[model samples]
Target: MKKINEITEILGDDTSYYLDHVSKKIPKERLQIPGPESVDNFRESDRSPQVLKNLAQLYNHGNLGGTGYINILPIDQGIEHSAAFSFYKNQDYFDPENIVKLAVEAGCNGVASTFGALALHSRKYAHKIPFVVKINHNELLTYPNKYDQISYGTVKEAWNLGATAIGATIYFGSKQSNRQIQEIAEAFEEAHQLGMATILWCYTRNSEFKTDSDDYHSAADLTGQANHIGVTIKADIIKQKLPTNNFGFREVDFAKYDEEMYESLTTDHPIDLCRLQVANCYMGKIGLINSGGGSKGESDYKEAVRTAIINKRAGGSGLIMGRKAFQRPLKEGVDILESVQSVYLNDKITVA
Candidate 1:
């Protein structure tokens, strides 16, 4: 409901800031959207008819208004970030049912959560909204915090729970990366066979990563490779962090690039950096859904809008927001979700 100018006014005039940086890059022309025929081609080539039907239904749902864009509500953080940390700020979400209710009320295209969170209420809400069952998680309670993710449920179990899609996280740069890749590849193969779409939470987590340097774990270069791997595994959708930098290539011995490569491959602008991530997802063949990290104080809504704008402008699919949506009062959560969806539905916000 807010115009781009109004949002920029709230963000002040730090032109280099993400909000201002992205606003200046909004495409003058309308976004070149893929039609239903393209969706059909995508589904037929990589997914089953049942999976395609389910995805189409999700695309057509809620405030998305049949735009074929994603607006997913993911709540697997309770397992990933710990329940106490995840729900303490908003105790109502401690009840799994409230989590489902929030997504349904917000008119999200789909909801992604842990097995127990979605399975317990499958009979009541699964039919109402597409359920993206997160089959793997890395609990934060482990000592020393190993950078790895493990599966918690089988794809068959996910199918039985009426899952429209299945999601898993891969700590792409860790020592356990190979094993995680092999395990998830097998899981995704079975999920596609069972007529369930696959989503990969492709993130970079290297213990040896130099945090002080530009080539950190979350750099676009590393996360972009993570997305490429997700697509190689035949994941129908790739979920990644919105890239902030593109220096990961410098961290490893096998890869090297000059300063000019950054200008040629990426830009200082936030949306341009994010586009490099989308470009890695088979150039949009595999949809790119960005993770909505943690909330940022009173600017949560403003941040959400800014992220949505950047993702859309970067030619990514949509947002799979978690904490920023559920860690607030129900009304506020719904408002945030709707605001993000508006960025996709509004024609004024277009991809370059």
Candidate 2:
């Protein structure tokens, strides 16, 4: 694998520009963790040793091959977005077995999917790789696309199916936010009691959200607050979207944050925007994994690589790529996933 510095140079101009600026500011030790030797310090917490061991197993697997980072394959989109919409391009994934096969073939650290997808083949593949059962999902099939995540299964069911972790989504800005938070918090508490780690998809979705607005749902400020909530709920890992802009101050009147504070703290670079998001995850005590939004034609691979670089450089836990990998052929998907792993494995890329 090429060094991260060299890899940045080969990327297109846009990627190289951000890398050039951010690379200089990265600390000598980019990947940080708790406990001795980068192992997560969950031993001191209420989590059992088995839970810590399972979490360590996930971080230690995959091409990155260590405990300081992660590269998970989340395939729950089949239920979130309709199956036809998610797997239309790659018909092979229509089979639930193929989804597990893809994660195994690609050597992902873990695979996150719905209860049915993982449970149906749990006897065969659950022991082969770390399984993350998505306990809840929001389907778009409903009229006007309701923003609520109904429980698909119980945490105990996931543990019985040999899941190493349990994941759930919470629409932060929606009317059901309070209820979702309460439900997920209780679920995560139960998951911990069962010796399973927890992952929260801390996403913001509301009808009032405007895509063109600077402080929209995906902005750094709001998403950072979402991460804070995830950590408060005791999520072992927090999955969030990459922050595109800083629109957080507009939503509330509690603090008087000016343009100068935003620029100085987050800067204008995309990587810095992501860095701010990580900063909100209990100051990086909890793992922060960014989502791989959607595919962008021929630029999908390049964009994935760029996202990985930014996430890694900004002190993120890793990437939980879904649609970008599964939408393509298995071989192509594996290649893209490997490229993402390469970014984290490259030792020369420094970020403290």
Candidate 3:
């Protein structure tokens, strides 16, 4: 897709409209992010104009609808699981370049990764695809902590390294969630200022809500709330785990979710749930995308694609898939990506 000067186009010389819109839309609390002053002075020098230009390429491929579903292939397994557990068993899965290639070849909206991986491949394949630099991460293999750290190159640095968007994970239920919110807000604001978009991984954890899907209302409400927070903070695309029928909220009635009720929302199998999610996004007035959990079997992966397509048809923004694509052999991964793209963009499906 051709790139347009969206920044200038959106806010023309009549700056009052931009100022008024921003002031009314974003809450003051939402805008309360610590600026560069909070960071040590030593790191400030790198936040240069030249650096931001390079980073904008990572997330913005300038495709899809001007603002469409962002089918992102995220492979941060090395930080989430043991390196060997994630990639060593199949060395083919360890190469970041292979993952990026799969995303591009398969027609993904973009690929998200840590700085090292993006820096290595952006220049060689910059024209081939768009990239998103994951600015914050937490390793599960490490000693457990209340929350994760932003152990990455700065957002400005990531743009300089050639990223179009930036990804940040926030554990909403964590004890340190407030700090994470502040951190992400700062990055989100900065990224937008530089004419780039932001994708937020809004996960819920360390709360009363368990991982079980059968819980019904509680889980749905929890995920919905997390998504709400992301939207409230002005995320362009908010990503969350696929919610189960379970509801984490007591007021929700799980048994009421019958086939007739489901059919009322849309024709897709999970259309009811997807519609509910879309409703939540509509209520919050933002785009919601679901994440592809870890690697799964073929059937499971296909089902995931089916679910994603359902979400899209039900008014979803797109997907943020990871291990499912990257864990496979590179070629197979690329094929899986293409299949997903075909399903998402073209609405072609063979799955039952």
Better of 1 and 3 by TM-score: 1
lDDT of 1 by residue, 1-352 (tens): 5566655554565423543344223231323343333355374385778778766776677777467688899998788888998889999988899988998999998899999989999999888998999999996778987667878989999999899989999988788899999999999899988988889999887766655555477787778888999999988888988877667676564365776766676776778877778777877767788888898778887778778878877888899898888888889899888888877776766675
Model 3 TM-score on a 0 to 1 scale: 0.71
- Runs of candidate 2 with Cα error greater than 4 angstroms are 1-6, 22-36, 211-215, 251-264
For candidate 3, give the lDDT of residue 297: 68
Question: What is the TM-score (0 to 1) of candidate 2?
Answer: 0.92
Q: In candidate 1, where is summed lDDT lowest over 10 consecutive residues?
A: 23-32
Residue 258 CA error for candidate 2 (Å)?
Answer: 4.9
Per-residue lDDT of 39 in model 3: 16
Q: Give the CA lDDT, 0 to 100, for residue 283 in model 2.
A: 61
Q: Could you tell me which residue pairs clash in candidate 2? A: 27-352, 30-351, 215-247
lDDT (C-alpha, whole model) for all candidates: 0.79, 0.80, 0.59
What ranking emerges by lDDT with the best candidate at the front?
A: 2, 1, 3
80, model 1: CA deviation in Å?
A: 0.6
What is the per-residue lDDT of model 3 for residues 306-351, given as tens digits with 9 covering 90 to 100? 5565555445666777777776676667666555554444422111
The C-alpha RMSD in Å for every predicted model, in order, reads 3.0, 2.7, 12.7
